[model samples]
Target chain A: MLLLRIASTHVRNRLRQTIVSTLGVALGVGFSVAMASLMEGSQRDFMTTLIEAIPHVEILDEKRNPAEQPATALYDAVAFHGLRPLEDLRGIRNPTEAIASLREWIDGDFAQRLSGQSVLRYSGQDIGMTLVGVVPGRELKVSKIREDMRAGSFEALDATANGLVIGRKAAERLGAELGDTVTLTSANGIAKRFKIVGLFHTGITTSDEGLAYAPLKAVQILLEKPDIINSISVRLADINDATRIAARAERQLGYKAVSWEEANEGLMEAFVVRNAIMYTVVGAILVVAGFGIFNIVSTIVHEKARDIAILKSLGFPETDIQQIFVLEGLVIGVLGAIAGCGLGFGLSSYLATVKFEVTTDIEMTRLPIHFSYVHYVLACLLALFSSGIAGLIPARKAAKLNPVDIIRGAT
Target chain B: MIAAQPQTGTDTSPLLQTRKLTRILPAVVPVTLVQDVDFSVGTSEFVAITGPSGSGKSSLLYLLGLLDRPTSGEVLIEGCGTADLSSAEMASMRLAKIGFVFQFHFLLPEFTALENIMIPMQKLGRLSAHAQLEHATGLLVDLGLEDFLHRRPAQLSGGQRQRVAVARALANSPDLILADEPTGSLDSAATEQVFESLQAIVETQKTTVVAVTHDMDLAGRMQRRVHLVDGRIDYDRVQS
Candidate 1:
C-alpha cells in the first residue's frame, strides 16, 4: 500500500512526464488496434466474397499422369512420362447414384453441372467463353449467382429453351442484351443460336467477361451428351464442414471433390503472410512504446535519488522500492491500454461510417470493419506485459541505489 | 540532569559500540574515510561528532546508524555484532532500533507533514492505518506542528520542516536517533528552536542521540563530544 501510494504520488507530482509516458503507450495501442481492425475487416470481406461466390464443395472430373513406358531408341533407354488428356474422359456416368449418395451422407444443397469452352458471337464481336448449364433453382442454393443477377431472372433462363444467361461484362463487350439472340459454336463445328434471358455481375473481370449459363437440358442436347453430367456443386450448412464432406463425397462417389479451402489455398496463404506483416508492424509499435516507458521510468529513478535515499533510510527494504516503480509502470500500462482501445473503437467505427466504393457482387458502399473484443483483450495484455518489463529494468536500478552514497551527496 | 559519565549504566556493556571501525572507499586510488576509530554511545546520552569538512564525521555517523558497512572493524548494537548480519537483517535492526534525520530535512516533498511522519510507521507495518495516522499526528503535535500537520514541506517554514523531519525520525520510537547536522541549513533562531525541540524529545523519550555538526556551540550543549581529525578521534570529552 505504501509503495503504491508513493508511486501514485510521484506520478501526480510529475504530471507532464506521466502524461507523456501514458500517451506514448496509448498511441502504440491505438495504432496497433486500428491496423488490426482494418486488416481483419478486409480479410473478412475477402473471405465472405470467396465463400459466397463459389461452392463450398465441388466434385470435378479427375485427370492423372499416365503410366510411364520404357523403350530402347538408338541403344539408349528412354522413358515417356506425360499427362492424360481430360477431353477423352466421360462424365461420372452414374450421376443419379453419386447425387443420391451425397444427399444421403451430407445435409447440403447439390446441383448437377456441365461445363465446356466455347465461343460466342454477337453483333460481329467474338468472345471466348466457358459455357455452364445449371438447374437454376438448385444452383441458387449452392452459389451466389442468383443474388448477383442484374437483369431478368434465373427462372426465365431455366424455363426458356435455348436461353443463355450471360455475364454483364461479356454482354457489354459483345453488345449483347436481354432478349437478344447470340451464336454459340462448339469446337467440333456444332453451333446453336440462343437468346440471352438474364445478365449477372459477379465483380470478377474474368467471370463477368467470359462466362455464360444455359438450361441443363439445352446444354445437354447441344453437347450431344444426354443423361450425363460433369460435376456436382454442393453447399453445406457450415462452410467449415466443406473439407470433411468433400473427402467423404470423394471416397464414396469415386470423383475428386475439392473443398473451398483447398481451391483457395493460394489466397489463404497470401492472407496469412499479410497478417504476419501486420502483427509484426503493430508489435513493433508496442515495443517502441515500451521503450518510452523505460526511458521515463529510468529518468524518474535518476531524479528521485534523494527521495529514494530518504525512504531507504526509513527502513523501507530494497524490494519495496522495486515494487513501487514496477507498480508505477503497470499503472501506466493498464491506463494506456484502456484509452487506446477506446480510441481504436471510435476510429474503426468512424472508418466504417465513411462510404467507399469497392467492387462487390452484393450492394456494398462502405469499408467493412468487424468489431471484436478479442482484439482489445489481446492488445491490453501485450501492452501490460511490455510495459511491465520496461518498468522492471529501471525498478531494479532504483532498488540497487546506495542510500549512503545519496545521503552523502545530498549533504 | 543529563550529565556525561564513562559507562554509567553498566561497565560491561554500552547501548551502542564500535571497535576499531574503519571505512575505506575503494577505487583506483582508495580513500580512507574513517580509519581505526573507536566510539560508544550509552543509554540516554547525547553525543556530538564534530570535524572539518571531508573529515569523515558523517561517515562515522553512517556506520553507527547501520546505513553503511565498515571495511575492517565491527559495529555492535546492544553488544550484538553487526558484521555477520545480512543487509535485510541490518535493515530490520535499523527499523526496530535506530532512526536517522538528515540536515536537509529530507521529508518527501510530495507528502504532507503528518504523512511524512507516517512513512516509518507504514514501513514497519506494525500499526493499522488508522492507528498510524493517529500516532503520526501525535508525533507532530508533540513537536509543536499540529497546525501544519497537513502542510507539505514547501508550504512550511524552515524550522517547521526540520521539526517534521525530527518527528519522522521519532516515528518508530527507536532507541537512538542519528542526526547528520539536523540544524545545518537553518538560521540561528531556527537552529536553536530545532535543537531545543530535539533536546526535549531526547529527555522525555530517554532516547540516545548521536548528531554530526560543525557548530561548536551546538556541540558544547551535548552531554559529550567526540572530535575527529583526519578520520581519527582527536578528543573524546565529557561535560559533567
Candidate 2:
C-alpha cells in the first residue's frame, strides 16, 4: 500500500513525464486496436462473401471426375447375331435418397443439382458456359444468388418451363435479354431454345461470365436424363463446421463431399499470411511504446536515486523499492490501455463508415471494421505485459542502487 | 574470515559492537575508508563521532547501521553479528533494530510529513495501517509537528523537515538511531531544537544514539565521543 501510495504520488507530481509515457503507450495500443479491427473486419467480410456466394459443402458423384468424360467405344457393334445393345448410363442414381441423406447431415439446408458444360447461341454470337440445374426454392436457401439478382427472380425461372437465369456479363456477351430465347446445346449435342428469364450480378468474373442457372427438370430434359442429378449442395448452421460434417457426409453417403475451406485452401493460406503480417506490424508499435516506457522509467529511477537511498536507509528492502517503480509503470500502462481502447473504438467506428469499393468480390462498399472485444482485451494485455517488462528493468536498476553511494554523494 | 558468534537475551551488554571493522573502497587502486577500527556503544548512550571531512566518520556509522559491509571483521547489533547476512536480511535487521537520519532531511518530498513518517513502519509491516497511523501521528506530535502533519517537505522549513526525518527514523522504534550530521544544514536555533528532540527521545526511550557531527559544542553534549582521523580512531573518551 505504501509503495503504491509513493508510486502514485510520484506519477501525480510528475505530470509531464507521466503524460508523455502514457501517450506513447496509448498511441501504440490505439494503432494496434485500429489495425486489429481493420484486419478482422476484412477477414470477416471475405469469409462472409465466401460463405454467401457458394455452398458450404458439395457432395458430388464419387465415380465422376467432373474434369474428365467417359470415353465412347470407337467401334459400333454391328446388328449381328448374339450382339447386345449398350445401355444408357444416367447421373447419380437415387438422387432423392442422396439429397435426403445430405439434408439430414446438414443442420441448415441442402440442394440437389446437376451441372454440365454447354454452349449458348444468341443470334450470331455463341459462348461456352457451365449450366447448373437447380430447384429454385432449395437453391435460394443454399446460395446467395437470390440476393445477387440484378433483374428477374428465381421464381420466374421456376415458373417458366424453359427459363434461364444468367449473369449480367453473360447476358451482355450473349446479347440476351429477359423474355429473349437463347439456343442452349448440351455437351451431347442436344439443343433447345430457353428464355433468359432472369439475370444476376456477383461482380466475380468467373461466376459472372461462365455460369448459368436453369430449372432442374428442364435441364434434365435437355440432357435427356430425367430425374438424374450429379451433386448435392449443403448449407450448414455453422460454416466452420463444414469440414467435419462434409467428412462425415462423404463417409455415410458414398459421395465426394468437399467443404468450402477445402475448396479455398489457397485463399485461406493467403489470409493466414496476411494476418501474420498485420499482427507483426502492429505488435512492433506496442514494442516501441514499451521501449519508451523503459526509457522514461529508467530516467525516473536515475532521478530518484536519492529517494531510493533514503528509503533503503529507512530499512525498505530492494524488493519494496522495485515494487514501487514497477507499480508506477503498470499504472501508466493500464491507464494508457484504457484510453487507447476508447480511442481505438472511436477510430474504428469512424473508419467503418468510410465507403470505398474494393476491386474484388468482398461484398462491401465500406471499410470493414470488426470491433471485437477480444481484440481490445488482447491489445490491453500485450501493452500491460510489455510495459511491465519495461518497468522491471528500471526497477531492478533502482533496487540495485547503493544507498551509501547515493547518500555519500548527497552529503 | 571468521564470523563472530551472536549472544542473545543478555541485559547490560553493549547494544552495538564493532570488532576489528575495516572497509576498503574496491577500485583499480583500492583505498581504505576505515581500517580495523573497534567500537561499541551501550544502551541509552548519546555518542558523537567527530572528524574532519574524509575522516570516514560517516562510513563508520554506515557500517554500524548495516548500510555498508566491512571488508573484514564484524559489526554486531544487540550482540548479533551481521557479517554473513544477505542484503535483504541486513535491510530487515536495519528496519527492525536500527534507524538513520541523514544530513539533508531526505524526507521524500512527494509525501506528506505523516506519510514520510509512516514509510518505515509500513515497510516493517508489523503494525496495521490504523496502528501505523496512530504511531506516526504520535511521533510527529512528539516532535512538535502536530500542525504540519499533512504538509509536504517543500512547504516545511528546513528545521521542520529535518525533524520530520527524525520522526521517520523513529517510526519503527528501533534500538539504535544513527544520525549522519542530522543538524549540519540547520541554523543555531533550529539545530538546538533538533538536538533537544533527539536528546529527549534517547532519554525517554533509552535508545542508543550515535551521531556524526563537526560541531564541537554538539559533540560536547554527548555522553561519549570517538574522534576519527584518516580512517582511524584518533581518540576515544567520556565526557564528565
Query: What tens digits encode model 2's per-residue C-alpha lDDT throughout A1-411?
Result: 778888888777878988998998898888889999999898999889888888999887764243222232343453345544555474677888777766664688888898888999998898898999989988998888888898888779778989999998999887778889999999889999898889999888888899999999989987777878988888888988989998898778766889999999999999999989987887888889888888878888988999999888888889999998998889889988999898888889899899776765555588879988988998899999988999999999999999999998998
Q: What TM-score do all the candidates reach, one by one? A: 0.92, 0.92
TM-score of chain A of each: 0.92, 0.89
> Mind sharing the TM-score for model 1?
0.92
State the C-alpha lDDT per candidate.
0.86, 0.88
Give stretches of model 2 more than 4 Å off. Answer: A63-90, A103-106, A224-226, A238-240, A358-364, B5-9
Worst 10 residues of 2 chain A by lDDT: A64-73
Model 2 Cα displacement at B34 (Å)? 1.1
Best by DockQ: 2
Worst 10 residues of 1 chain A by lDDT: A63-72
- Per-residue lDDT over B103-171 for candidate 2, one digit per residue giving the tens place of the 0 to 100 score: 999989888999888888888889999999999999999999999999999999999999998998899
Error of 2 at A135 (Å): 2.2
TM-scores of chain B, in order = 0.93, 0.96
